[model samples]
Target: MALLETLVVVFAVAVVAALAVVVKTRLFPLREGEEPREDVAEYISMMVSVFYALVLGLCLVSVWDNRATADDRVQTEASALHQTYLLADALPAAQRQPVRDAARAYAAHVVEVEWPRMAEREPLGTEGWALLDRLRTAGELTGRATLSQQIAAQEVLAQLGYVDDARRGRETAAGESLSVVLWTGLIIGGVLTVAFMFLFGLERNTTHVILVMGLSGFIAFTVLLIYQLDAPFGATLGVAPDPFTRYFPL
Candidate 1:
């Protein structure tokens, strides 16, 4: 629902931009004197460009931090999960395989099932979490063994904490209100910048090259910025699901 609302807002902005362009070009034709004196248009464009750069830099910083934090969280979770797995070996023979099997199954379900859905921003189902609970309960450490199990259990619990926090971070990164706004600004600024170009009476031979360069660069930078943030779990640039793979896998 929130995503849908964001889309609607963006669509509305695009519509407004299109209408503004039509009206500006058709009715308020650009003329040397009709615009402000002392190259006011140029000054405004320069200021807006500078501001846009600042905004772009800020967005990069934010996303980079978000990705870095997510990575750290996953690493922490992996460490905790590893401790729990090793502890399984110290359990009584009858309980060791059961504990390890439960952990492995939980890890596999997370990697195979939960991840792809998160990529699409879907809520993780309750079943995987239920499995985690089962893994915790399967310990069956009573009295004397309980102390050893606590050491491992505590670590696994900590890892689970990290995993949950990291998921929230990943989700937060995607739902960044400012990112959508920054993208809106970049796009609108580019259009206004380009449209202002058309208003200039440039020579026929020289205009195309400059126009192509401006549009190409704008499109490339703006697009990839958004794309890089879209997935928090898929590639090297994305959040590492390796926590599960390294410690929990069969």
Candidate 2:
């Protein structure tokens, strides 16, 4: 969803919840002797809030670490590709241009074609692997080449190995997400945390409304933030193709 739409939903839920608390207090005012036991309620509420906070922390950490790993993969892949490109200079005259061209083509495909697919959470298929294979084929040299050329070819292969590993890491990161069980816990926890506020019988209806609204709004924002970060490539704070562009500007 767009930022504006998300904000609207968050604010709408908060306002509706706050209004419900208002109506609830009006309809069922707590009498002096009828007020629920504050001590027990406070204890339970504190425990629930603490557990919910733990869940939120776990979710935030999971997504943040995934994003950081995705970023690292991008940097590694781009650096390896750049190294391969530079190594092409030491190759034989007949082989140098092909290797460089293949490197450029692979970079272009990643930045222009594959990036959008990743952002859309679409299947990458085998196109990227095929491109990488082509790069490997282009770098191949005959036994007629000298020792230096052979050594350059070996270095190029090593760099391509890094690129392959990093690409795999990147793809895995793109598909990674919290499991359904964790998601269920997160949602249930947030709801219970917010609902606990309703059990309290504060003297001022205004104060009660304010507390519920603030807690609900903050929880809503946190959940949404986690959702956005769950998609490492697609989210607003997602990994970018800047590493590729920096190495092979198009």
Candidate 3:
């Protein structure tokens, strides 16, 4: 509930900030009663347009990198899990099934249970990572066995280690704080740029007004979309866990 409220607040602030640009420009004239500075205003507008373009480019690149990072983390984790599964054959007969079961169970839990909570930005329940640890330990205990089994056991342990590290990476990546800051800059930049639209005693040109408002609206909307999707695991507008789900039982 608290997180939802925070998200709402973030969203409200962004929307208001974005719309403020349109309203400040179209409805209220900031340069009322001032003499025209046509040449200076035109130059400033051109510069601001460039600024807006750069900001937009930065936002797109930032979000794209975040998505790619999350996807790569998923692939790394999945690869480890699969490798662990195959390496279970190295375990003694008594321990082989246990390790395999744990691996599959962890995958299932991630898909069916953890994924939903993560999507909602909720912390995962206990027993999820615990189960993974158990699988790792089970693999480690295969020590001093047949050489082939020992090698296999080592591979499984290595893969399990990979899974642990990848999971940690996912946690860090999913936070996506850069998006938050980018949003702040984007929205503030948009508002300030548009506010400048009405500055300094300029004669109202209908065409210029239309162009300014249209550009403002588009920039604002694109930034908002990027903000919503910045968190790859977030429910608002993020990557779905269905890909992870496929590895699970249910």
TM-score, every prediction: 0.71, 0.82, 0.74
lDDT of 3 by residue, 28-64 (tens): 6668687745886678777876887798888888877
Candidate 3 colliding pairs: none
User: Quick one: best lDDT, which candidate?
Assistant: 2
Worst 10 residues of 3 by lDDT: 241-250
Per-residue lDDT tens digits for candidate 1, residues 1-250, read 6556777887899899889979988897778667445576678667866776676677667767766766676676556556667777766566678777877887787678877766665777787768767777766564565566667655655655665565456455534434566666666666666665556544566677687677768756765775676455545367757777876654
Clashes of each: 0, 0, 0
Give residue 220's error in model 1 in angstroms.
3.1
Model 1 segments more than 4 A misplaced = 1-38, 146-179, 206-215, 234-237
Residue-by-residue lDDT tens digits, candidate 2, 1-250: 3545655776799799889979988998889689655797799889989999999999999999998999999999999999999999999998889989999999999988878888887878888899999999888886599999999999999999999999999989988987666687788789888887776765567877788788899999998999888888874988999999998999
In model 3, where do residues sit more than 4 Å from their true spots? Answer: 1-36, 142-144, 179-181, 195-213
Candidate 3 overall lDDT versus native = 0.76
Cα-lDDT of candidate 2: 0.88
